[model samples]
Target chain A: MKQVWVFAEHQAGQWTSVTGELLVAARNIADQLNGELNVIVCGDQVEELAATLKQWKVDRVYLSQHPELNFYHPLVYTETIVDLVSEYGCPEMILFGATYLGRDLAPAIAARLGTGCAADCCDLKLDENGNLLQIVPGLGGTIFATIVTPFHRPQVATVKPGMLETLGSSENEDKAKALKPVEVVKVEPRFPQNTAAIQLHSVKQKPAKESGLQAAKRIVAGGAGISGPEGWSLLEELADVLGAAVGATRPAVDEGWASHDLMIGQSGKTVRPELYLGIGISGDMMHTIGIKGKGTLIAINQDPKAAIFKQVDYGIVADYRSILPVLIEEVKRREG
Target chain B: MQPLQIAICVKPVPDPKESTQLQINPTTKTLVRKGIPLVINPMDRNALEAGVKLKEANGGKVTVFSMSPPEGELTMLETLALGADEAILLSDLIFAGGDTLATARVLAAGIKAQGNWDLVICGAESFDGGTAQVGAQLAVLLGTPWITRVSHLKRVDDKHLLVTVEDEVEQRELLVQLPVVLTVESVVNQARPLSLWGIVEARNKKITVYNADTLKLDQKGIGLDGSPTQTRDLFAPDASREAEILTGDSPQQIANQLLDKIGWSRKGAAN
Candidate 1:
């Protein structure tokens, strides 16, 4: 039977949302190919994580536990996955979330396995020959390209987070409980002698600024049209009034008006907020691709012909500076 | 502490500012990159700057390497202008159409032929491919420890370095031994602007061109034949969502209409 694998990425003893997203994508591929879906969990004490996989739509879970595996060591993790594949023979495909750890691990494993790895793919589909088609944005996010590993056995891809949907937790829990328990396999992890060359001395949590773009319900974004620091501060004010997170176009970030973490586009965060207000955005596909959420999009631009107008639910043709204060006042009046 | 030896790998990518002009050859399923000018991949400048700064502080040499067609010579010269001690271009017809793995293999061969070095640096990813794989793959091929997305780096001693790596949620500080590969983030340092004297000096610097024969690379393992990934199809995405233009006699009127339409009131506030 064909075999498909998903790397279950977890941090701080909780599964990242992308792990659930990967499972959803992997489950579809497994059903289509009549393959067994397997989940791989590697960490210091991840038996509970492995057991939790029984409630997922998977056939088996492979757990590799070691003290050194607590934190992600690139070489050791890559070696563990490569050894597992070698022991069980190569599978048809493997999927990973395009997180920092996933991006680092997938490529290293692909190099060791002598296979192809498509990074930050937005979608995955099977071709007529059952080969995985890795869909990614290209040419500065102006086009979509389907990449294939025609001759490689184990197709590897790191999928972008928030691009795929997952089953609601309540619905999934009920359905999964009716299915048979997934088998768990334990593997012994081996490390290379040179692993000591890179030693992690400390890990510090990033300051919690601009942290919730992925899960935010409302977002207010700015583009080059916002012009300077004053305009950016105004944008922050509007976001604060609306209880929205601040977002920016690549140009705005390039202009040093916002941090890169607040960038929304093909190369940055993919946001699916309930409502998105874009001020002075020209709406390049690179930025629009990240905003295809089910939301009420409103754009304010001086140019009636701005590309952003065509993609929004409501567009006001005026200079954003003229419209912002009026809108902020009207919102406050309604609150009063 | 002896002076360090550093090697930096760079790529000449199509200028991202000219992205609107980039097109796909429908029949060949490839990018039609004739008119677009090439620039050193943006982040690679950070890597080059990091290397140059390290050399400037510690008194050493920094070499730059790239794998591209002959057209890439201009980009290599730009690196020399930005303070690379020397540059090497591994260009040949046989090395065309390679993916990340093949690219890393050819780079590994090129760097290996140049003898041993204390450190190798690269941009975390390229703007065009955006795969972010070659550095790690190159490190694997060279048999060295590798770190990606290094935001801060300092020389602790001749044999050790202190580096900070950033991911999505946290920053990790690592103490790494010498003879390592580092793929740096753009935030590591601002790349220095080119000076007139640097350009003049660059004109006199040596840019060695090495081909497959000089590098002694295997015929079947350095190009399209060796690359595992291939493009099956390419096309623009459908983005034809027609928006409703909100019009009114004045700004206040339009604001009120927009608010009412979206049901933004005290009772229905988003928060």
Candidate 2:
């Protein structure tokens, strides 16, 4: 039988949410191909985490535990996975979450294995020949491109978080309760190598106010319409009341009104929040692509025909300057 | 310390502000390259700036190379005007439709033709391509170590450098050895604008253009033919959406109505 593998990403103490999503995605593909679904979890003292992975529909979990693997060292992690593939049989498909590590690691693994990898893919399908079809947005989400890697084995793709939904555990629970028993096989891990050249000297977390935009549950974003610091201050007041993170359009960042880290567009961070409030953004293709599949997009722009209005769930075609202060007051009153 | 040999990769993309003018050719599976003005990708300017600063501090030469149409020579010249000592343009009709992997292979070949280099720099990703794959692919093809999302760098010695990389969660400072590739983040540095003296100096700088045969590039390893990934279809995404536009004469009335539409109440606002 063919095999589908997912790189179960975890950092610090918790498993990233994308891991669960990938497992759900992998299960569907594995069933379609009548293949075994497996996972590779690499970390020090992560056997307990590996055990948790076994609770799912996975056929096997490769737990790579080494002192050097305590943290995510790019070279060591890539070498470990490559060694694992060489030892065991190579899978027909590999998927990763399009996180910072995934973005940095996917291409290297693809190059090392002499295969093709589609990065930040939004959709995946199988061709008649069983090859993977990677659907991506190009030209900053202006167009959609369906890409295929027909010649390469173990077709690889890194999917952005929130693009795929995690299959509920209730179904897995039922399967575990009935039918054939599933015992998740745990395989040995490869030894970590090549740790001398790159040294991790220090890691500094950003202040709470400025960090975690991608992982935030709520966001208030501004665009070119937000003229200057005063406009940002208005957005900040609203954000403070709503307890939402702040993001910006490319032009806002270019104009020096906000930092690059807060920029949300094709060139900036891709955000998927429960509530995305775009105060002044016009919903250009570049900005829209980053938040394409987000949950609820509420746009406030003066132009009734702003492109963003077409993609939003609720649009308020009024001047943000006029609407913002009132909205801030309303939110404050509600919170009180 | 030995003079550093830095090679920066740049791509000329249509000005993002005028992106509405771009069109995808259905038959060719490529952008309709006409009339739209092109500029050096915004992040590539940051990478070039990083390269130039390293050269300025460590005493060496910074060479830049770009793979685009012949019109891209102007972009390469602009890169020279920014601060690079030499510029190379890889352009040919045959190299027009290559994807990121094929482009990386061509760049790897071009970098090899330029002799030994201590370091290579590139932007994290391009706005048009939006694929942060080239630097990694290029490093793998060139058989060198690489680090992406690098925000800061300092030369520690002839053989080593200090780099601060922004990972997903935290910022890490790393000590990377020579002969490594670094893909810089947008926040790496503020790109320096062109100066009168710099533009004057660039007038005398050499801007070389190389084709397939000149770089000794294998025909099978470049352009659409060499690319492993193929774009089967390209089309505009559906923009039609069902959005309810709220209306009210006053800001307070509009705010109340908007709150009602989004299923939010005064009590529910408590986060």
Best-performing candidate as measured by DockQ: 1
Error of 1 at A97 (Å): 1.0
lDDT measured at residue B238 in model 2 versus the true structure, 0 to 100: 68
Each prediction's total of clashing residue pairs, residues at least 3 apart in sequence or on different chains, is 0, 0
lDDT string for model 2 (B112-224, tens) is 99898989999989878888899988987888788898988888888988999865577788888888999998888999998998889999999998889899888886788
Candidate 1 global CA lDDT score? 0.88
Q: Highest TM-score, which number? A: 1
lDDT of 2 by residue, A1-336 (tens): 799999988877677877888888788888899999888888788876666665457888777777767756777777778887887788997899888888888888887887788888877778787888888877555677888888877787898776666666677656655444334445554443445667777878754444689888888999999888998999988887877899998889989888888987655777878888998888776677777454777899998988888888889998898999998888777666
| lDDT digits (tens) for residues B65-130 of candidate 1 | 999999999999999999999999999988887888899998999899888799999999998888
Q: What TM-score fits each model?
A: 0.95, 0.89
